[model samples]
Target: MITAPLPLDEDLRLRSLKRLEILDSEPEEAFDRIARLAAWAFKVPIVLVSLVDEDRQWFKARHGLATCETPRSVSFCAHAVFSKRMLVVEDALDDERFLDNPLVLGAPHIRFYAGAPLLLADGQVAGTLCLIDTVPRSFDPHDAEVLAGYAQLVERELEVRSQLIRLQTAHERDRRSLAISEARFTTVFKETPVGNALVDLDGRFLDVNQAFCAIVGYSEDTLRTLTFAKVTHPDDLAEDLALVAELLAGKHTAYAMEKRYMRPDGTAIWVSLAVTLVRDAAGVPLHLIAAVQDIDSRKKSEKALRNYHVELEERVRERTAELRRSRDALQTITDNLPALIAVVDRDLRYRFNNEAFRRVFGTPSVALRGASIQDTLSPEVFESLQPLFARALAGERVTCNEVRYRADEERVWCTTYIPAEREGKVTGFYVMSHDVTEQRRTEQRLREKALIDPLTGLANRRALQEELGAILTHVGAVALFFIDLDGFKGINDRFGHDTGDALLREVARRLAATVRAGDMVSRLGGDEFVVVSRGVADAPGAERIAQALCHALARPFVAGGTIVEASASVGVVLRGTGDAARSVRMHDTLALADAAMYEAKRAGRNTWRLARHTAADKVKLNETRYPAEKAKSNAKKHSEF
Candidate 1:
């Protein structure tokens, strides 16, 4: 038998093949249809659009073939690439080169082959468009011509695909450059100190900066879901609408005003708004660019000065008409304030201090005029407050609450630091402190009373539901155990209420101790409780937790000298790492777990049962401890349970 010789232009042929860049790509419907058509036209069992690489013949499209490629040395397409025209073997059994070929002798058992070499524009053969038959057949001149026409169509499609790929590569490079430019512009838009918004001509928010979100007390995501008209103050909305109409009508290119924006919590804030119209190249109205400066504090200060002026006018009529004396009277009013107010420079030295501030620090205003906080406060206290000062200096308005011990009494003081800006640069900060010890203590006690269970000291049912709802919002695996104390009512009837309460407390302690630290146990009303655990992997992880909880509760309880004993029936629902796990709701999970608990009780109490809220198996009991003897013995025990 003779082997097929390689073409003299083999290196150039491989270069042309590599230039197509079609290897190892996902199959496209365009190429797949061509292969299917070729197989049907040639009346052959198999047809392949194969490309020969250095070591292998990779199929771009194949019909009726399980493998994607074969060794190049043994490939029928490899032999066909040696000729410019179609190659036909009437009978491979009679052909010297293919008589001992494994493809003709074993699997596929090709006895007839017809292939037209796929020639590129560079006049080099890349591979073939081949047809194969299990039985020997003869191909006439007409068949060869028809096959060659199909091969030309395949080559034309390959060239088009290569051009499309190159164009796509160039387009992707342009897209990436545009994205980088957009990202840099977006960073500046989001982080700028002045509030900025991109709004459509219809007054809908296209994008908003973080400063704008903070000013309106709405998140960036929430603002995008609303129109600017929705957040405008009701009294000011009509005027804002008129201004926008004028802008859209080409009456004004820009406008500025001091307007009010309504916050989410129903509070109004004043802002200095500067709006400019953006237009397309053809002068069509595109969007409105709005820049907002928060001016609430300035507005408040102006109002206060106006009131002081009115009072000064009344004083002039009632007492002296001297201007210098009116100023002295005004200073006296500020000095007598109950709240401690002071202004400190960037160096943390006092620029000005009110009489109230001096009294609180137990220093006279004349001596404390230019003193630093380090002079009055200990090193430890100064260090503790340094970070807050630093944050204020960084242009953040910060509020802090601190406890101060004065002799035998402790007082809580709320201090707010407002950064003072001069010409867009931070110069100093204003400080105000007021006592809020009683109010803070009352709030803390109220919060604890609302969240903690009165009896078990565990979290109540409300907190448990909240925790479960939070987990459902984020995607993760979670397992819930619904535990019901079995035969607790019998103990309450026989041993009395006091003994039952003791057993409940002990059970709560044991349940808390049985789970991981990240897990939460809650008392859901009477004898029912729930445990919500996160980071649990699959059904087996949940089953292990259920088994541990059963063992913890299976221990005996001694209460009120009656030696009360009770066990728990637990049902576990696991949200495994499956496709639909994240979409499951808290209530649905609870209902399924509750149903499984009843199944556990029906399965003769104290043994845990698993249920499918996920893709896992349903109604499965613990595998390690299914007792055939105990099942028969206690089959009728919990029939009423």
Candidate 2:
């Protein structure tokens, strides 16, 4: 009964085989181990974990065959996948499908055969778990059932392998997601460049980065043992700790403040501190994140600027004192002065003009006042004056000496310029004018004065009292000191007045330049001078200035072709706000200051005496000398003010 071969649905069969997802996989011991035992159990010559393909049966493991794949036209298992029921041939010569199949007749001659369909998970035929024997045999239903049970076991293993592949894929996805999240966390924590810390619930540091470690000046290991409180400066401790406690108690999620952090060496640094409490899923506090930014440098700059402002104020006070002196002298020497006095703005516009200006310009000083200089001066003068205005407006103080006017009949000499100031940007100017013609005439009359001393303008005495007063007001927070030149008479006699006068003038100028604004130097008489420094910083301040003066005057003073030198004894008296004990009274204080000066002279010729004000200062200063009670009732004045 040779007939045409059965036409297999090749595509569906291949898809069914692939759904197993087991093609070309390594021989798994779970399935292969089953094949080995089955080969032995059935006492068969061949056994296979075969996956059916479109036109072939491929073996995952073959017990009795060396070939891995066989052509389906000759394959015995191919027919099995097309049928769900087990196929058995009691004798191959009797079955048409197997009667001429080459595998049944070839090298591994299969005269008897039994194969059961391998069921898929989707309920379709996948392949077969089959056994083959060389000789024809009779079949029993029970034996067919028993071999079918082995096939089911192989199917179970295939299912498990599929499950493992899915589980492995899921695990990889989860791992990738976690890695991305951790990388983001690392980026956020490390790059901010501020001091940041992660601390446990008990406020112990778990981790901190390099910036935080540098700020606190502690190693990671050392900081781990200490809580945040240990690094807080004492002045800021109470407030910072209170915020910490509040956050821990759930009063707030975050707290921030400007604080000071103490370094390992116990120095404090200023920082703006911000802390946030991190919580767990249950809303219970778990850790704290602290961020600290150092502000010490910025704070120092501000303090330096403040100090600069104070120094600037002292300079203004000195200039104000000079102006007040000139104002006072105007009352004393009004008749002998030259020309007019006026104050103008940066534009050379008048602020005020004196009575002399009204007579000289002929126009009402008020009418010409607040008008530009171009109104009265020529174009050349106006152009020259522009640069002067620009300098003054730029905060420079300018002085013009001996300005000759083409408009005047006589060649005139005067000093005129503006005072410079500072604002946020632009500097405003204040104009001051002085007439020197009469003063120059007076100076010409005193030929003897010029010969005596350059500073004092005294015939015999050097310039003294005025320069002493000038120095006193310049250096604030100082003590006034007096000094006496000792053992000077003999030197003058031996050297002649020419050298003596030179020595005196040298001493005067040296002393004036050395001391701060608080101290003053005066020539009371020949070989005697007093030093006064008010608002002295300390006794040391006065002592240092005095020592400097002594060294300066000790240097050679050359006069009239002769070289000579002299030394002075010094006396000191303390004054001003920082002196808590009001020890010195006004008149009596000057007397004491004077007496101390004399005592230094008496002690020898070159020593200094510092007035002791502590005991008496506590007694006499019990009452406030200033801010006196007035006739107006205190309540009424308070209301008015």
Candidate 3:
């Protein structure tokens, strides 16, 4: 056996590996696809993109391994990382270095090994893309070339992932800075004294500052329902409409003229009004910013003196100065948000949109205003969403989840459509949307963590009980095997918990390998595990599974430089297919199975005992027939182990 040598630039290699920041990340489909493809190409049972950390080799993507990592001392990938070349060993038993290796002598029994070293962009070796098999095999030059190409794929993926992380970090920083700027601008808008209002191109009020509501003598809610035409005096309405038409036609950027407003109680007030057109980034008119001030006093006093006219003119100038601050603040707030905030009328035409809506639809927010949804969204998207929008406009508040395609990305969004109503009538809907893809992914990960055992990567007690409950609910025949490792406590005392944990992981792998493809194996916390086999036709089939589990657990486990032998005393129970038989509760079944497991220990170690419980007997469970203390009695009898 030839012991592997270290690389010449080991320090540089370690630094480069750490810099990628790919270790311990959630598995990605890109890397998993590479591993699966390699396994299929080589006709090997296992393939891994293994990274060599300081003390272990961690698998980023694994094709067949149950474990995600292993100590570096036993890692075959550790030897391959020494050079940027393909390393292949046809057989390990014949090699000097592996002749006495525990991996060669125990479970998984690796004989064939091949690896191609993966390198960073800086030309430092980080790890290897490796293939392994239990049987010895030979490879040719073509095979080596193909394997080397796979290494290049891994290197490119790592580089791309690192770049994406950097880009995301920079984007977050920019967003934070923009938020700060928007907040400062919002403060200025709130503090300004001028009567400023933002209205849709069609003249409906979208937002109004406090001063605007005061000057109009209407609450904000009331103003939202009334268009500029509704409040304008009949005599001045024609002139106001003509000026707005000129602005929309691009013949005028703004228009100012004195206008008469009719109050709620049949009174008329004269005001000086200046309206400016606001456009989005792409130079499309979006909103009309209107500044209004009460000039009735000035008009009435005009005949009294010229001094009053000068004083009123000076006040109007001061008000106009403050209006500029409000406009700047509104623009800043709308431009920074990624959320899609918009309003649409009963006619299905857009009334307003924030910056994100413009970016996604590939149209300026100002230009998109007053356009139909069918015109803004793709045909497929429009057809699917039209009904939801209609429901909102019909006075139904709606919230729904949707996935939409942006230029080159798919994003999950939670959208809420609120009905904008006035005087008990629905006028339009307010649409607000925000991305929820990352949040949903996080929730899924948390659910997986709860169900999967962190130590062995198998199902845990929670998963086992849930599966059993599901099987019972569906009324299926099941075989349950409760396995307790023999002498596991002694092994922990003698070898330490780390080795004990390693032994358990290896044992779990063996148990999983022994079961049929559809069987469920779970670790029920420390030294105990349960196997649930569904769709079993008879007790004999379950007995065969029990026998297989016993023989598999009797094998030796290699961990922490030690070859530890162990055995399992398994208790088996079979439930037949019938409503009555499946009606048994999960806890009672587990308790009966546990009682039977202790009986197996008494019968002797390294064997299985089947506990028989009929449908009628299960319905009549009590201390008299199958006493609850039977497990304790069995344990006390076999306490010498």
Candidate 4:
């Protein structure tokens, strides 16, 4: 170990060094061994692995040097990183840098010196490896190079330690984010079909679920004496402690990893843990709630799975020389997996394929191979991947989204394309997808059931969300005309649902004819059907159309020749981003239109209400008060308006 000279101002250097936070740290043996070896090899009395930070220099390891560190102003290593080369003082008395250095002239007298800079990942010269001696001596080059190697070792250790710290921090963040509840605790511990426990901060048992007691072959009373550590196998203690240490340090608040647990009967139970920290309102850590899924079944499953994986891997390795064999193996795996899989070439031609694709697309995997994607799948999906395919062909892997229409029905769902590569260049692509068609169908059916009226097929409240979501994306202006029929509930209660249904159906037919091209008329159920118009030239355009629908409906619908009065409350919400210069958030725009429709009902029944967007207009208005109030008022004035 070499003790380099502290500058003439010793006290000033120590002050600058304290803020680095690396001084007098826990014993990491790698550094301790290097410092010891350096001292003997160089025949010097002092060696230190010193780091330079914002204002201080700290020692991770030191030998022959009594104090932990010094200030940057009086340090040799601070100068070493700036030089961007080794700092070697064959004789401190002769060197100009040393003449003014305090250690050279004072107590820890320094004459010979050598140091190497430890570079951090960010290119900051974080610290240096240094050596020193009291007597003047010229060190050998081999010794200097070996010292440089030791410095590299320190740099590597710094990286490993830093990563560990980061991992601990992430773990702690997860712990802090997730909260605990007795309902969740009981559900997880008692009903989870696995062993579980609640332990205090010190690892003492507080509670164990029935499954845990049964698994350990111990009564609840019998398990109370033991702390968690007492039953943990020796082999599993290190990792268990490592995670716990991170938790204790507040570096991690929760932990989840696989490890075995020792049962009370001295048997080690293989398990997977998902544990979290419980805390009080003031954020003090209280206890740990852990779910121990008895991995014994999963372990048994894994054994079968591992055997299959090994067999699969071996077969693939044997055929690695041929791409076709490899593709075949891939197809085999995909066929058995629960998802649909397909492959496409640079031009979107089908390449290697899988069984799931065959099942869904109605073609054999081999038959589909080499066919164009557009020829096999819908044009919508093929066009969506056009850019992604182009990118993949240009040697880039792409994960792009697409939507495909179901050939069996008029429905669509999402898919993703993952480009495949070879030898540093993308060659083709792999498609792994799930059929979300059912999900979309479910949503549509639910919306229809909730929002659409059975008597009149019209857009319901649930349908409104989807409609607005779609309409807002159109940057072009839109006219939202909310039409509430003048009288319908009275017809239903008096004339029976049969005649009411017919009157509503005729009203729907007349309204549908009055709207222009690209306009939508949906029976919002009962007597309310909203007419949403796109490319509305102006408010007058909406007004003219609203008047036409009102006039068309006024003429007797003649359902059973009962020509009673039927009027409408037309509220037109003129929406879109205001002006060509400003981009209104389309989704928000649709919501505004929805609010304005209810407002039309609010103003009066049978007449229309209109609101146009302007730069001066506030987008966020009181929607809650208007929607419910409008629905109730409209129900009351069913025929009056």
Which candidate comes out best when scored by lDDT? 3
RMSD of each: 23.1, 39.8, 27.2, 27.1
Quote model 4's TM-score. Answer: 0.36
Segments of candidate 3 deviating more than 4 angstroms:
1-46, 60-64, 88-112, 120-126, 133-143, 150-194, 200-206, 227-252, 255-273, 278-287, 292-641
Taking the tens digit of each residue's C-alpha lDDT, what string does model 1 give over 290-370? 877788544533433333333323332233223223333333444655566677899899876778766667787657668
Select the stronger candidate by lDDT from 1 and 4. 1
351-460 per-residue lDDT for model 3 (tens digits): 87777876676788889878997887778877878889889988898888765735367678888899999899999998888787875675468466698788997888
Show the lowest summed lDDT stretch of 10 residues, model 2. 619-628
Residue pairs in candidate 1 whose N, alpha carbon or C atoms collide under 3 angstroms: none
Q: What tens digits encode model 4's per-residue C-alpha lDDT throughout 1-641?
A: 23343335434434433423345577689888989987887778998898765456778898988787777667778778666578888887787766768888885898878999886665556668899888888767887789889888887887777677668888987664443232223333443335667788788888887767866667777667777777777898888878987876767556778887777667887777766665444446667766565665665334333333333333333333342344443455566654567777767787777787666777888888789877875787667667766776776555532355465665354555666777876768777666666656764686657755455555555666576667665455567776766556777777777777788888877776666423566765556677776655466556766667667776766775676667666666666444541355544454454565556556655566665554654454432433446466545655443
Model 2 sits at a Cα RMSD from the real structure of 39.8
What ordering of candidates by TM-score runs from best to worst? 2, 4, 3, 1
lDDT of 2 by residue, 1-641 (tens): 23223336556656655755788777777777888898898888888877776666789878887888887667777666655678787788778877777776777878888887777676666677888788888879888998899989987877777677778888998997767455434433443345668888776888886668988899989999998878878888899878888988867766779998899788888887767665544556667777676776446334333333233323322323342344432322222223455556655677655555555556665676687777866777677667777777666667665554455555455555555444554434654445456656655665545433344543322333344344333433446665666556677678888777777777776776665432345666665555654434456556666666666666776755776656766766666543343433444555555556555555665667676555535412213221233334323322321
For each candidate, the alpha-carbon lDDT, in order, equals 0.76, 0.63, 0.77, 0.66
Order by lDDT, highest first: 3, 1, 4, 2
For model 4, the stretches where C-alpha displacement exceeds 4 angstroms are 1-24, 90-107, 119-126, 135-143, 149-366, 369-384, 389-412, 418-641
